[model samples]
Target chain A: MDEQRFLEYVQSGGQVETTDRMPDDYRSKLVKFIEMHGNSELMGVLPEREWILRAPTLQRKLALTAKVQDEVGHSQLIYRVVEDLGKPREQCLADLISGKSKFHNVFHYPTKTWGDVGVIAWLVDAAAIISQKALLKCSYAPYARIMKKICWEESFHILHGRDVVLTMMNGTDEQRELVQEALNRWWGPLMQFHGNPISKEDDPMYIWRIKSQGNEEARQQFLDGYVPQIWELGLTVPDPKLRKSDDGVWEYSEPDWDELKHVVTGHGPKTQERLEFRRKFLEQEAWVRSVVLAEAA
Target chain B: MSEKVQKIVEIADDELILGWRDSEWTGIAPSLEEDVAFSSIAQNEIGHARALYELAARELGTDADTLAFDRDPGEYLSAPLVEERRMDWAHTIARHFLYETADEIRLAALKDSDDAEVAGLAAKMDREEQYHRLHARMWRDRLQDEPRFVDALEELWPAAVAVLPEELRPQMSERLQLDLPSNSLLRGFERGSHSEELRPLLDEMTMVRRSVPGATW
Candidate 1:
């Protein structure tokens, strides 16, 4: 089939696997988009993994560890899908560490406290899950299949996050303060987490059906589902204009698109430190990979 | 504390500290698949620590959280082997293989303990340990010929034996085909000793807990 027929097929709910013929644009777009999702999941673990050590309770420690472990697992699953699409996982890691690729804007920031931990799991995972749930209909079959398992594990993370938040919200004034402070810090990135609202027609990812939902649509879903939960705790969101319209659309202040661009381009506060940390391990562990890869060869 | 409580704390502390070290690899392991597999092992160690701490908690009239996070660095009973944060894959895997081997000997002895509760928990823990052992063995076999991996194993072997009691060290050495109770353990961290690595770890491990004293995390 020609480009037009392939486009029509994907737009109308068709799926393609590794061996399927596709337009060059679709293949490259799919590799880049899916690889970024895998990168985001991998980087997302760093902020939370620190808290896994500092978790105040045995239960919280285990929960946080398991949650971070799941993120690593998701990255594994995602990178495998990309590898099948022709990008080796090693190439993906090299590109990520060298700052030649981008992850989600949220992961580029740092995690400050246990409060950041709860807020991330609760809100950040919620935002990610919305995007992931939409990908259940991803035009790429292998990516779509992995999204099923990824979505299932992410639901548990949201609960774990909310549980951490609720426990703090119900505790001492200091504990409550931690949650409020973390929420205040994370609200900005949370808004930007879904990406800028480029038109579906113009966004290559959407045009190819790799992402079944528009960026704005996902943000609206996150607000519609979570703002009430945030409000119920008597916690305030940072935005003054965040509210629901009479027509049921959620409205909020415009996100800093420039900030999003800058951060995703590798200038975020913790990006260098985080990337260096990963590179250190990768270089240190290069021998192990060589041993294993040599055997495979 | 009774001898029983001390012994439980000893093992629990090892698992707690080791798990904390292992988790440092959450996203950065050599391969993504290995990353996930290794992380589960890390989580399992923490889980084992929690269970063992609960048993100790009941005896001490406190709680698992208190035993796990509230203790000072010097108070922890973990061996020196697990105290250091070795992230190198060869060293980490070497430590993993050695630690699991030593733990098998230790757990086996506990299975026949006079205390039924301890023995029962040991049996339960052993069932779960099968996967950890298999994982360690699988990596050992794969990396046996790698020079760095071999160096790591040789360097860490003595430390691994030190993790067991003097009485059990013989059994561990016999299983690994190394000399028993060799004076050459990279350095011995007997049960009562604390490594330089533990304090920095405890500080990070308890930072949030310490920040909001008497509050929920």
Candidate 2:
């Protein structure tokens, strides 16, 4: 099919498979977008993995470990989809470590306390799941199918996050303070997570139906769904202008699009440190991969 | 503590410490697939630890979390094998394979315990551990010819035997087709003494719990 026909097909909700003929732009765009997602899942775990060892209870430890495992599992699934699209997982990892590709802006920041853990699982994953749910309608069939499992596991993560927050809120003043402090620190990244409020018509990801929603639409959905939950916990949102309009559209102060662009471009505070950490491990373990792959070949 | 409770806690401590060490590999394992698979094994080990702790908790008037996170470093009953920090894949897999082999023998013995409760819990844990053993065996197969893996197995052998009681050591040795070390050699690495690693591990493990004393996490 020609590029125009392929565009018309995907625009009307048609799905594309690996074997299907398609335009070079669609295929390349799909690989880039999907590879970043795979990278995010992999990097996303490092911030939370720090807390796994320090989790306060056995229950929390197990739950957190399982959650991190699911993320790594998600990365495995996502990278496989990327691999099937012609990019090797090794190439993806190399590009990620070398800062030749990008992950979500949120993961580039550091996780601070147990409170950060709660906020991340609760808020970070919430923002993530909104984007993921929208991808359930992705024109890429393999990527869309995996979102079903990814979305289901992510629901449990949000519950785990909320549980951590609720327990802290119900406890001592110090515990509640931890939650609020973490929320305060994380509020900015959470707002900036869905990307700048680009219209779907112009965003190529949306133009090709790689994602089913606009950037602003996802950020709005997140605000509409979560702001009430945040407030009902008697916790304050850091944004002064964050509120619902009479027409039911949620309004908030403009997020720092500059920070979002800078972070995803690998200049966030923790981005270099995280990439270095990943680079160290990947280089150190290169021999093991060689062994396994050589034996298989 | 009753003899039965002490025995249960010993095994629980091994599982808890081993699981903690195994989980340190969550995102940094050799491959993403291994990271996920290894983490499942780690979670299962911790789950087994919790179940064993609960069994002992019933007799001690405490709960599993209290037993798990609230203990002093010197008081933990884990052996030196699981306590050592070996983050390298060779050492990690060696420990995994060796510990799983030792645990299989230990659990089999417990499954025949006269105490029905102990026996029942052992049986359930064994069922879950089947996967762990399979995973360890799969890695062992892949890495069997790799010199580093072979060296790791040999280096960790004494500590692996130390994970078991004197009587169980023979069974582990037989299963692995390796001869047991002298009683004196094994005795030095046995349970009852805390490794230098355990104190630091315990400090990090309990840091959050200690931060908010007595608060639900």
Q: Pick the candidate with the highest lDDT.
A: 2
TM-score for candidate 2, residues paired by index = 0.98
Q: lDDT per residue, candidate 1, B66-129, as tens digits? A: 9999987778889999998886888999999999999999999999999999999999989988
Q: Which stretches of candidate 1 lie over 4 Å from their true place?
A: B181-188
Per DockQ, the best of the predicted structures is: 2
- Cα lDDT tens digits, model 1, A218-238, are 999999999999999979999
Q: What is the DockQ of candidate 1?
A: 0.77
- Per-residue lDDT of model 2, residues A1-297, tens digit only: 889999999999999999999888898999999999999999999899999999999999999999999999999999999999899998999899989999999998887789999999999999999999999999999999999999999999999999999999999999999999999989999999998887799999999999999988998999988999998988999988988999998888988888889989999999999899888888888878988898899
lDDT of 2 by residue, B48-127 (tens): 99999998898999999999988778779999999999988899999999999999999999999999998999999999
- DockQ scores of all models, one per candidate: 0.77, 0.87
Candidate 2: give the clashing pairs. Answer: none
